[model samples]
Target: MELRTRVVLQLAMATGAAASTLQMRWTTDAGACSSNGGQCNSLGPDGPWQAVMVTAGLENADSNSAAEVVDMPMWPAVGSISGVLTTSSGGEYNPFMSVSANKTGVRHDAFGPWLANLFINMTDEGPGYQEILRFKTSTDNSDELNATIVAAETWDIRMPTGAKYEAPAGFLGLGPSTAEDNKSIPPGLLDQLKAAGTITSNSFGLHMGSVALGQKGSLILGGYEQNRALGDVGVFELVNEVTRAFIVDLTLSVETGSSPFNQTGSMWKGVEGSEYGPDVTKNIGGVSGSAAILPSAVTPYIYLPPGNCEAVAEQLPVTFRQDLGLYTWNTEDPAYARIVNSPAYMGFVLADRTAQNITIKIPFKLLNLTLESPLVAEPTPYFPCKSVDSAYGVWQLGRAFLQGAFLGFNFEKSVMYMAQAPGPDMDQGVTRTLEVDDEVILSNAADTFEKTWRSQWTVLGGDETGSGEGGAETPNGSAPPAVGNDGQNAPGNKIGEAESANGDGETEENLGQVQEQGSLSVGAIAGVVVGVVAVLGLVASGLLFWRRRRRQAAKEDVPEKEWEAESASGVHFPGLGIKYEMYAPRVTHEAPGVELRHEMDGTGIGRRSMRISQDMYANRI
Candidate 1:
C-alpha cells in the first residue's frame, strides 16, 4: 500500500526564486520588511535596505519570533578594587577584584531594540546556584545550574499612546544588594596554586574574586536604590523611543564560557514561558518566591558534573557564585569558549587559581529580518498577506543541533558559607566569583553559536558538511525561526499546560521559543514513530468521490443491473461535513488513546444510511 504525507515548510520559500512545496527559503531583507516572512537584529550597525525572506510553510521571525534574552556586556569598568589577605599557609592573599554598585537604571525596556541590546551586551552569565553547583556528587565534579527563576522571552512593555500608561516594551528589571568589595579571600589563591601547586585549569575574562559579596548582582553601584519589578537591578540598557514599541527576540546561553568542574554528561533544551512578568500576587507568606527576574531576559544554562564530593553550586537568579566567594563554571569545562581577558586582569588559571581562564564564552544571535519590516505589527496598516499556519516545526529544525549543552566550573577556588542576619533582621550571605575580560567582539557570540549549531547540523547530515541551519552563511533551508501564535508574549507570563493538538494531535504554531517550555525526555524520543493520518486518506477519497459524481452527472445512468451492488461492506463518504466522520475510523489505529466525541447528528445520519442499506441488502447478509 502506498501512503502519502504533507509537510508544510516556510512560506517565504514558496514565493521565491526557488519555490518547492516542501522547502521554504527566506532572506534577511524580507524579515525586516515583512512580518510573515522575516526576522530582526536587536543590536545596531544593521544597514538600511536589508531584506530577509521566508518561503512557504516557513513562518517569518516577525510572525513567529519572541523577545529573547541576551548576555549583558560591560560598557567599561568605571572603577576597580584590590586587597591583600594573609592565609594560614603564610602566603599573601590572592588578588580578588571588586566594584561598588552605582547602578544607573533598573527599568530600561522602554528604549527600543537598539537600547535594549546595549543593556544585555553589558551583562554576562554569572556563577551557578548553590543547589546544582556541587563539586562532586557520586563520581566526579559536574557543572549544573539550577535555574531558580525561569527566564523566558516575553514582550511586556508596549508603546504608550498617551500619558499615564506605561510603554508596552517595559522591561522587568531586578538586581542584588550589597557592595562589590571582597575582604577575606586568601591572598594569592591563583598565584599560590599556579606559582606552586598540583591542579589543572585556567583564568577568566571578567574577574571578581568572590561571588555573592563582591560580584555585581543587578545591584546599583554604591547602594543607590533602583526600582525593580521584583528584586534589585538597573534596566538592561538605553533604549530609544522607537524601540519602546518594537518587539525583538534574543536567545541567551544560560552559562557562558567554560567549565571548572569535571563531569561527563549533557544538557537539553526546555520550554520557556512566552510572557514577561508573571501575574501579580499580593500578601503571600508560606513558600512565596523571592529574587524575581524579567522573563524576557531568560536563557538556557549549560550542565556539568563533579569528580570529587566536596563542592556545591549556588542557584541565585540574578546573582553569581563569584559575588559570594564561589568558583565559576567556565574555567574548568570550556567547550570552544574564546579566551578573552582584560590586560588589567590576566586569564587562564587551571594550574594555580590566579585569574580564571577568561574563556567563558557567552553568545547572542540575530536572525532573518528585512529593513522595512523589522516587526510583524507596526506603524501602519497591517499587511493582509497569505500567512503560514500557527504551528512551527521546531523539532524538525531542532533535529540539526547538538541537542544538549554542558556547563563547567571550578570548585576548589570558589566556596560558599551561609549566614543569618544581625539581630534577626536577616543578613543574606553568599560570596562567589565572576571574571571579566576586555575583549569586545559583538560578533563573537553569534559566531560561536553558529559554529556549535553547525557542528551538530553537520553530524545530523551524516558527514555531509554542506552546513545546514543557524550558520555564518545562510543555512541549508534558511528561513525564519518560529514565532508566537501571534507575535506576542503569553498572557501575563503564564505557562499553559500541554494539551491535545487538533484532530491530528497538533497544538497551535508560530509560538517562538518563548512559549517552548515543557519537559521532553530522551526516552520519549525513542518512542515516537511516524504514522499515517486519516485526513489525507479522506482528502483522496473526496477527490475520487467528486470525480465519480461529476462523471455520473455527465452521463446517463447505466442499465439497472449494470451498477455494481454498492459496497455495503464498508461505508465512506467524500462530501462536505460527512467526509471526516466517515474516514476517521477507517484510517485510525490509535483511537483508544484519543479523546472520543460522539456526533449525534452523524449517528442519526448513519442510522438513516443503515436503514437505506438494509433495503438494498435484500436477503444478503
Candidate 2:
C-alpha cells in the first residue's frame, strides 16, 4: 500500500491501542558491543566504540522499570507522513525555531522526494564510558501511516535496523537504532596510532535534543557535525527556506502542482553551556559547557544513518518529497534592522522603529522562538564564580532571554505567534522566507532579524562605520544624520563613547563605567560558592574513605560502640569526607545540660591520623 493511504487508517487505530509493554536496562562496561550488521567488531578491542553503549526497547515509561526482551524486527517502516499548518487567515506560517530537519509526509501532487525517519539500534562504547539510546514506535501495516510526521503526539512505533555484529552483553537491550553505516573501514591506520600511543584524555558526555513523531508515520531529515571536539549545528535561514518551499509546494501539489521536496537543507547549533562572556554564549542542558556560535555561511552537515538518526545528522530518503527547514539565531543588531532613508518612504521616519529595511517573506514568512535555555558565559575575575552546591538552582530559571522573533512554517492551528521585529529601513518587518534552492534568507527579513539581535546588546555588531553608529542611508549614497526629538542633529557616527559596546557597535558614553561595575552576576557568584562547597565536601569524603580503608586493613581496636553510634548519627556528610566517630570524635563541646567537654583524640577508625605519624595526629578539617 502507498505510505500515505496507510498512515490515515493506522492513525485512527493508534489512538485506541494500549501502550507497549517492555523495558530494557541500559548498561556500560568492559564488555563487547555491537549488533548483527557485522558492526560489532568495531567495539571489540582497542576501539573508540568501546567507550559508549546504548540499549533501547519498546516499553512504557509510566509502568515498566525493569529490562525486558522483545522482538527487534517486528516493527515495520512507516510509508509516509504529512501535515500543513496555516495562520488564522488560513495563511501558512513558518516555524520560528532555530533548527530543523528534513521531512516527509502526504501530498499526492507533491514534488520529487519526501523525507522519512528511519531507526536502528546503536551504541558507541569508547574507552571511558558507554551511551544508550532508547525510543519507541507503534506497529502499523499501512501506507498513509507515512503522513504521520513527528509532532502533536507522544507514543510511537519503535523499529531499528543497521547493527554491528556480536555486540557486548551489556549492549543487548537496544531495539530501535537510527543511523547510517559507513559500510567500509579503511584500515588500522588511525586505530593503530592511538593503540600504540597513550590516550591522554577521557571526557565522557551526552547530547540532548528534541524530536517529534509525525502525525501519521514520521519524517526523514538529515543532520550534520563539525570538528569532532564540537558536534553539529547548522544555518537557520537555510532550513527555514526549505520548510517554506515545502509547505508551498505541498499546498500547490494538492491543488495546482509544482516541483517536489527533492533537495532541501537545515541549520543547527552545538549544545549550549557556560564558557564565554554574558550575551556571548548559550547553553543547552545535558551537554556541558557553552557552544560558541558561528555565522550561517559555513555550518556543518550531518549524514543520517538509516536508523534512529543523530540530531546532528539525519537520514533522508529519495523516494518521498522532503524539505529541510533551517532555524538559527539572528546574528545582527536592531538599530540597523531596516533602512529609513529609502526612496519609498522619504518622509518623517519612526524612531525606535525596530524593523528597518528588511525584506518580507515573499513566498513565505519569518519566525522566532521566545522560550529558550539560559545563555552560557564564564564569570569575569571579579565575577565571583559560583558552583556552590552542584545543583546550581540559583543559576537556573524557567526563562533566560526574551528572544521574540519570527520564522515561517505553514500550520493548521488557528492562532500562532510571530515576532514583530525592526527592519533595517526602520520599517516594521516580520520573518523572511527564502527559496529552498538558495541559502540566503529574504533581505529585509534578514536585516530585521539582525536588528532584533542587536537589541539584546548595547550596540549592533558589524556596523559599517566600525564606530558602532546606526542611521539611514539615501539611495543617492548620502548618509543622513540622526535627529533628536528637539529637531537637533544628534551625534551622527560616533560609537562606543569608550569601550566596545557588548560586541555590537553602538556607543554609550558610560560603557566603560558599566564594564567596570561589579563584574559578577548572581549565577557566577553562586557558582563560586558551589565550587568551594564541593571541594570541601570532597576532601571530607576522601578522609573518611582513607580512615575506613586503613581501619579495615590494620584491625585497630575500633570500639564497636563508636563505629555503630557514629555511623548512625553524629555529623555524617558522605561527600564532605568528614565522619565523626562517637568515640574518636574530633569535636570537643560540652553537652547541652552537662558541662562535659568530652573530646576524643583525632584518631580515626582504629588508626592514627591519616598519613600522619603517631606523634602529629591531632588536627582535622
Candidate 3:
C-alpha cells in the first residue's frame, strides 16, 4: 500500500544577522529594586522584564488521587508571616514579617500560610476553580531583584474534611482583570505586577513545557524565552475583548501511519466495505475561525468545530464517549503504541488576518495522555481533540495545543504572538526581555522543527548518520542526536547550558561552576557562539542531553501490558478530582393558562388571591 506525505517546511531560514547591540542598563544601584518595597524601573535603558521559573509537580504529594495531574506549571508567590520566635531566655531572636513562598504548596507538608483564608469554588469544569477572596499577593522574585504585592485572583480545590493538604498550585492570570459585563473583578496578575513595578509592561509569554519529555516550562513576565520559540512568529489581534480570543485560520493534517483512524474501514463507519474508507495519508482538511488560548483550562483537550473534530477523529483510533463528551483512545489497539513511539505527528497550520501562516507539529507521543478515576473508571488513554457546536462559540485551543506552541500576549498593544515551541530536549536558557513596543524576532536559522523530528526519528531506530529517507541533515552532515523514548539524549551527545544575559549587558559564564577541571562540550560552545553571533539564533542542541538518562529507556519489544501498567500507576490530570456536570440540550414548551380568583371577604379592602392554572385541554383541529 502506498502512503502519502504532507511535509510543511519552515517558512524562513535562519540568517547570519548580527546580534542586538543593546545592553541591559539599570538606572538604580544593585539591590535597589528589591529594597525599596518592590518598586523598580519600568521604562529605562533596562527593560522591566522579570523571569519566573515554572516547575511541574503535584499540588499535594501525599494524595492518592489518580487524575493525570501532569505538566502543570506552578508559579511563585510572597506570603505574609507575622510574629517572632522566642529565644531560650524568653527574648525575641529574629523578627520576620513576610517570606518568599517560592516552590511552596507542592508537597503535602509545605502548605503556605497565605492560603489559609482563601476559599475555592469549583465551576462546571473540573479542576478550574475561582477564589472567593481577591487576596493581595506579590510574586516571590527576590532572586530576580523585584518583589511587589498586588491583589489578584488565586485558584485551588477544596479537599475533604480531615484530609492533609498543602497550598494548591498558583495559576497566574494574564487576561484583562475587568470585563465589560463585570467591573468588580480584580486586576489580573500581569497588570498587578506592572503596577507594583515588578515588571515593565502588562504582557507575558508562556511555554507549557513538554510532557512527553518530562521538561519544566517557563512563564516570562514582560519578556519571553528567545530559544523556546522558533521560525516565523504569527501576530494576531485579540478579537474578543472579554476573553482575549483571536482569529486563526487553522488547518489540521497528519503524517502517514500516524493514526489508526486514517486506516480504511476504521470504526468511524459501522458498516463493512463502506465507501467512507479512504487512504490514511489524505489531508484531514481545516477549520477557520476564532480560537481562544486558555492556559488555565482544566483539561488538555483542544475544543474545535464539530465537523473539524469529526474529520480528525476519522484518522485516529478513538471512540466518542457520550458520557465524558470526549474521544477516548483505544489503548487495546496495536497501532496505539506504534503511533506514539513512531516519528509521526499531527500538523496544525495557524494563519493570521495577514495570511501569514506557521505550522505547529505535535508529536503523537504528547497526545497520548491518560485520564483516570472521575474521567474514567480506570486509567484510559484519551485524545485531546474535543468537538463542540460552533453555534455556542466554544472554539478554543487549550493546554494540549499550547504544549507545542509558544503563546505571548501584550494586552497594552492588544496583540498576541505565536510561534512553534522547541522540544523538551532543547536548551531553554536563551531569554530576552521585551520592551513595551518591541516585537518578537523570528529566527531564520533556527530549524527547531527539523531538529525535533530528526531527534525523534533517530530514537525510533532510524539511521543516525542522516542517510535515512526524509531526514534533514545537520550542518556537519550528521544527525543531531539520538533521543531516547524518555526524552533524554544518548550519552556523549549532551548539549551545554548557555549563560544568561545579566546586568551591565555582559553575559556571565557559569557563576557557580563547582567543576573547575571540566570544560564546555562542543554543543555548549556552539550554543554560546550562536548566541553571541545572533541573539535570536541560539539553538538548544543538547543542553539537557543526559538530564533524564537515568529513566529506563523504553524498548520496542516491551510488552503492551507492562507499558500500560507503568503509565496507569503514576500519571494524573490536574484539577480532575472535583465533580462537574456535562452540558446537555434541553427542550421547553409553552401552554395557555387560565387565571382563578378567590375572595375571603365581601369588602373591597378584604384579602384576595389570584392563581394561574395551565389548561391541558386539546382540540382536534
Question: Which candidate has the highest TM-score of all?
Answer: 3
Q: Best-fitting candidate, measured by lDDT?
A: 3
lDDT of 2 by residue, 1-621 (tens): 445535743653453222211111111211112232212221111011111222222233445343331111111111111122212211121222102222223222211011111111111111111111222222321111011122211111111112122211221111011121422211111111123331111100011110110001111011000000011111121121111010000011100121111112221122222112112211111122222111110001111111111111111111110111111222142212221111111011111112221211111111111111111122111100001110111011000000011221111111111122222223331212211232212223233333332322222123332122444432112333443333233344253122123223232334334456868676765665576457567767989998898788558655667655664563653222232121220111111111110100100111221222111111210
What's the candidate order when arranged by decreasing TM-score? 3, 1, 2
Model 3, 1-621: lDDT tens digits are 111101111110121111211112121212213222332222101111122222111234435643211111223221211111112112111111112212212113112221212111111111111221121112222112211112112222222221222222223334554343644334555555566665677666666665346544555666666766878887766433222233343433333322222222211111111111111001111122334332232224565443445555555556666444456766654445545666556666665536576666776666776665434557677777754332112234655666777777667776777777776566535556566776554432346555654555423333322222445232112233344333344334424123334333444344225125357766776676565656433333233443333233433344557645654443432112111111111111101111000110111111121110001001100
Write one digit per residue (lDDT tens) for candidate 1, span 351-395.
011211112112111111111122222321110100001011000
Better candidate number, 2 or 3, judged by lDDT: 3
Each candidate: what lDDT?
0.18, 0.20, 0.39
Residue 229, candidate 1: alpha-carbon lDDT: 12
> Model 1 TM-score?
0.17
CA lDDT, candidate 3, residue 590: 9
| TM-score for all models, in order of appearance | 0.17, 0.17, 0.45
Which is the better candidate, 1 or 2, if ranked by lDDT?
2
Q: How many residue pairs clash in each candidate?
A: 199, 191, 16
Stretches of candidate 3 off by over 4 Å are 1-170, 179-188, 239-299, 442-446, 453-621
